[model samples]
Target: MKVERQKDEIVVRFSAGKNASKIQSILDYLRYEELTSKSKATQKDLDLLLKETKRGRFDKIIIEMGLDEKDYR
Candidate 1:
């Protein structure tokens, strides 16, 4: 795996036969970091949000939006 930074973006390249899922996970994290770097939210805020999400805190909002967990399941 290799990483390079361009003027406004980062590029990642991997040789063939690497684990696809792991590469995808890394790419996802890098994309998230890039997107959040321009936002005002701090790591603490993100941690709290992730904690709440894991605790089903947004279930009510999902229901209100007419989205059911069963649909996803």
Candidate 2:
């Protein structure tokens, strides 16, 4: 994954894997969540939800940070 500013819009690109669809859906939910803020969800809530985030979620974030997922190996 990588985040770059293309013209005026931000582009998020990822090197997808076999479970990319599940990862995409989780990401979509998170993006939608940030867009629709009704109540503040605390850190604890996020931590719990992280366990349920599909495979490739961690990989995407790691790549976005310019780090290899193997760092967690």
TM-scores for the candidates: 0.45, 0.34
lDDT tens readout by residue for model 1, 8-43: 987778897759888789789988997877799888
**Model 1 misplaced stretches (Cα beyond 4 Å):** 2-9, 42-73
What lDDT score belongs to each candidate, Candidate 1 first?
0.81, 0.80
lDDT of 2 by residue, 1-73 (tens): 7999989877877886887998789889988987868868798988878775844687778878998777674
- lDDT, candidate 1, at 35: 86
How many residue pairs of model 1 clash at the backbone?
Answer: 0
